[model samples]
Target: MAKCTAVIDIGSNSMRMAVFQKTSRFSFHILHEVKSSVRLSEHAYKNDGYLQSATMNRTAQAIGEFLSIARSFGARKLLCVATSALRDAPNAQEFISRIQREHNLSIKVIDGEKEAYLGAIACANLLPKMDALTVDVGGGSSEFAVLRNGKVETLYSLNIGTVRIKELFFDRNDLAGAVAYIDNALSALPDFGIDTFIGIGGTFRALTRALMKKENYPLKKLHAYTTDDVRFQTFAEQILQAGPKKLKSLYIKTDRFDTIKPGTLILQRILKYTCAQKLVCSGVGVREGVFLNDLLRNSAASFPANYNPSVRYLLDTYATHSDHGIQCSHLVKRLFDLLQAPLNLKADYRHDLVIAAKLLPIGIGIRYYAYQRHSHNIAMSGLDYALSHTQIVLISHLLLFKKGSRSSSLIPRAGYGTLLPDNATVDALSAILWLSHILLAARINADTLSVHYIDGKLEIRGKHLYLAKEQLRNIVLPKNLIVVFQE
Candidate 1:
């Protein structure tokens, strides 16, 4: 086993340390993770170029603690990065010199474009196939990088972050002005033609937490979440109007309450201008990016195969109904194709629907009674798998319908844009998936269930599906259903 590698990220709002220990070939285990709210840029604005004395002292103490922990854990390599706050301070060089001389730790102040690129690398490792607009919102600046086909095409760094906005606009209670400031800063970047957006940093995480609570999301996992225009508008308004007292009631950390308003507005503005339909919340931020960079630098050949764990691997490793889930996915794809003409479902939407169908059964193993609810619960609760929030919401909706329920409104309250299938389409797919599961639960095997158009009617055929004599006789097929037996 290889020794752990640690990376320390000293940011304007927070400082964090993470350690990764090699577990096996192309696999690593997280050894330790810790974060502290140092807010090094808290009053750095008052000074010409260096962080205020108090802020610098607090940051140095945090770094010392992190370095001690890394050494105790026998970390062979350590990388420390400081972002905007330290980079912009007039006395940055002096501060860096003092830290290096006193602490024996080399600190690199990364530029905005490099920060955006590194963040994108971390995201790309997580979602290999996505065409994403990666947005990292930090204390002093927000970085944006467009990943087309898993490669960075464009990147920009803007002077807009939660702490920056809070310092500039919150005291005046000028919410509109804050929004304008963010919009103006972001407008300078050329459009990247992005349809999907991935958010990184504390503000994005805070937003995910708020959306999870509002929709009663079951999973605490953070990856991709879907937010619609309605949900976005509603939540944005709520956050804006909420006073500290009211916000605290929502269980948001007191320190985060003030920044939530401006952060939400910034996100809203990004979504509005980019026309992104889906938002993926990556838990990995600058720390993970830096760690990954070090990992690759140390041993490029030993890099993990899947940077972020996969849903399939998770289902196989931890889930009990993995086999059944695969069967359901296969069945759903067949039925989806059969009804595509009548349902008017686009190819991309159908692909997501099939994925939802396949993953639906993972929740049933929790408990038998109200398996529908359990299924819904598992899908939304971040299961340490690589799934966007929208995909999870869609899967939860399908699971609800699969268990003999018809509530299409059970989906979470994230902005999913147009990524979800229409209600009618979802209903139709759910009905077919449920019927197929009920028809083949006992006799499921290699044979595939299929639907077809025959003589102006939809027809279903499967070796085992027709063998259910009781269901064939008693089960009432929908008006559109036409059953055919193949001997």
Candidate 2:
């Protein structure tokens, strides 16, 4: 595989180019990106599947510009794929041939099923592992991939995207007929006892952004942001009632207001059709899927099945030192074994404990004072895609108190009634992490210390206890746990 590969995704609404820099197998990030809203479906669908000349010329121009940008970024290879609008266009081969002849760019026009598969590839590897209906609402069509047990069980593509729906249904005065048509198209979709909807593509992202803005959400990241069915229903209704003149006020993109409402209607029906209760938005789509598939084609390239993508991204981006974090994680695992029964904690928390241990000190690099709160902010905002929102909140709380700093004024206040568990579990987890920090801060050899739970009292048997005895005494712990220091 090339060190840097450029992926150009020609969709119905927009043509986008993403340059990915591969740091390692299954590890990469977008180095550069560019997009142009060509809206090929706007003309092609209205003109009997014949791609309009002006639209094709505009697409050719965008492709030429994107290719230039990619080359300027030192891209070593290129993978260009065109979706629905091009696939359904009668003269798509002519357009592809013209680009090839004029600019030496070979564009692969993928079928609906292949497009759905590529979209699923991205969702399976990058998003949280779950049973979901991954819906990619493009401009010319919508691709649905039903993921069961993290595998694609069914794939379907409907010729009803934002642009297509707007062209077909926006002018219809018979509201009942429009809904009936939508329902008839959606009736073919089957529900697999799955209530989670994973929404991909630009329309869903715009909705997530607007919803986040409305709530004054602190985190700006989009992946794995979930919205309840009630919120979505309200928004969908608002979009349905909003005219193009009023759409700009709804926080949708100015260019997208014309079609966003139609998109929302399509998504609302999809939610009902699939009996899904919640929608998790993903910023990734067919472009990322294409890149990942092309990358893994090389025999030496692969990603770990259990590795958390967002976790690695956060650690690589912000962490100053990983040795301490790794050592603390090891120490916490050891304590979970020794303290689980006494603390009344279950093994379910072990996964969160490990993640919190590694991420607890990331904020120290920003500043030492109030570093735990900083770490909390980083985890809440940066670490995502693998854990549930509840797990994320719990992990943030665990990291907040990891350094033994339990101030009443600290962040993540106790007002979230049921968001947190009973205080005992939090205290125990905090104390265990705090103890791990102190034990290692004493410069004791990581391998020399062993924990023993004796008669409900905690003791750390180590080779050099005398050297750090005074520092250990200064640290605070959960008052419930009887701690013993023995040399």
Q: Give the clash count for model 2.
A: 0
lDDT of 1 at 142: 89
Show where candidate 1 strays beyond 4 Å.
Answer: 297-385, 389-487
**Per-residue lDDT of candidate 2, residues 247-348 (tens digit):** 667777788777787788888888887878878988788988898788776622234666776676666666756567778888888988888888789788
lDDT of 1 by residue, 331-428 (tens): 66777677667656666656556665556666666776777677665655533434555555566566675232444555546644245667766666
Judging by lDDT against the true structure, name the best candidate: 2
Backbone N/Cα/C clashes per model: 23, 0
Error of 2 at 458 (Å): 1.5
What's model 2's lDDT at 129?
81
